[model samples]
Target: MSTAQRTAPAGADRTKHRKPPARRRPHRDQRWPASVFLSPWLIGVVALTLVPMAVSLYLSFTDYDLFSAPRWVGLRNYTDMLTEDPRFWRSVGTTVLYVVVAVPLKLGLALGVAMLLRSLVRGRAFYRSAFYAPSLLGASMSIALVWRALFNDGGSVTAVLDAVGLPADGWIGDPDLAVYVVVLLTVWQFGAPMVIFLAGLQQIPSTLYEAAAIDGAGRWRQFVSITVPMLSPVVFFNLVLEIINSFQVFTPAFVISGGNGGPADSTLFYTLYLYERGFTASHMGYAAAMAWLLLLAVGALTLILFRTARSWVFYADEEGR
Candidate 1:
């Protein structure tokens, strides 16, 4: 090789072996702005939520009467609730009944209404707004007051029954019927789930139905094979939410039953019972224990649903699996 070419090649080899410059990481000072911006949320979470949660947990194991300093009593509160308290189990049973009955009925009604809305051709917006109006209004004190008036003896409902030549008892007065009134109230406020289901139903492709029709599938067959399977995820979501909400149901029963859980304490839900124990009876520790138990129950039920969902909930992306 020529000396010039050899020299150029040697210079290239030296240049190839040279290290590149190192990249500079952002300074800690640069991250300060983001940290400052997040401080409010972090402070709120710690002060408002986490602290209260920890206090509640601590109070659950102690004998607290709100007026006096808490005395640590360990499992005594839980033991009494499980063994000595008949009202505890009664409240639990009432809550279980409400959750089991109300969740399915509300979800089914919501899904049905959603499907009906999805199939509508005209005045869809008006109907959607009208149907959802009840849910917005149902939880209000005004609506609860209205519910009380409607179901009370000698009220409009009773008058209607009398006009129809049918016997009517006080729905809110009868222990047997009080829970049913709450259930009816729950069913009437099905608008939120209906709106959610309507959104989910809209996401389903109409082409699936068209293809099923092409394959000679009838309406029922298409619904069973396509609609149910496709909408199972949304149904599961709504079911879980409804289960949680139903377990926490308090307002309607509280307002309609006059906060006494009246008619033999039949309308007394778990939350209402907790409120009575904590505030009225001043059994703060026992109420806290009840609250924790309720949390555990709700958590367990949610876990069970997640476990059960594996068998039936069909993810659109799971077809390959």
Candidate 2:
């Protein structure tokens, strides 16, 4: 055979041994579809939330009535609020008292009812619905109106108390008692948290209870050891949520007090006070400062909850924080 022909056959064999190139898949912009789907929420957060927040923060430092141009005031609004504003401090004190009193009472009632529901064997759904009904209308203006009427002078609550020979006068009028009336209103709407606690209860392992029973532990013992540790995470979650909700309470105070936060501003919650300053009195700059302070207060409380959660909140699958 000729040398050229031999070399050609060898080269052809080498070519046959080589692998073909891999094909590349075309890149699709998956993010665009997600962005399209998320556009509505993004627009709402920016337009209704972010823009307003930025504008308010800027206005907090300036004297901006609704009609006039914003005049720079530096830290005057904040300084005045901290020192010159008595109602500001009163509102703060009232809000703190409300949050402290209402949150624990609400959570306690909710947990107690949840435990009862967990034990009940019949008509559970009906009872759950009945209990949760109040939560549905809890924050509504209609419910606030109804509650006001129920507690008003010579109203149903007052009439009942009078018939029973107890002093039920001026629930919505007494400075000492008006705030408690609103607090009771909040506590009555415990169904939402009850439902949440019920869910958390169901998630706990029944086997643990069985084991505890076998170990001679009583129902109370099991609840203290097994139930509390297991349910701590849920309790913490509900605590944080209820705290936030309690701070933002408005409609009940507004409608109950006739939009004046009245009976001598006794029902003057922080948000109600903020609204009065901003719209009613046209102290827009001062109101803006109050709003920011509220934001900070809520943020601080939430942060504290998170920080302290490590001590109590537990997770089964992971190490405690």
- Evaluated against the true structure, the overall lDDT of model 1 is 0.87
What would the per-residue lDDT of candidate 1 be over residues 37-153, giving only the tens digit for each residue?
999999999999899888888999999999999999999999999999899898998889988888889899998989999999888778888999999988888888888888889
Report the error of model 2 at residue 80, Å. 0.9
Q: Per the 3 Å backbone cut-off, how many clashing residue pairs does candidate 1 have? A: 0
Model 1 TM-score is 0.89
Tens digit of per-residue lDDT, candidate 2, span 1-321: 598885455432245456232311111344578789999999999999999999999999999879989999999999999999888888888889999999999999999999999999998788888999999998899888888988888789979978898768848877877888889899999999999999999999899999999999998999999989999999999999999989999999898878888888888899999999999889898899899999999999999999999988888879554
Candidate lDDT values, in order = 0.87, 0.88
Candidate 1 local Cα displacement, residue 299, angstroms? 0.6
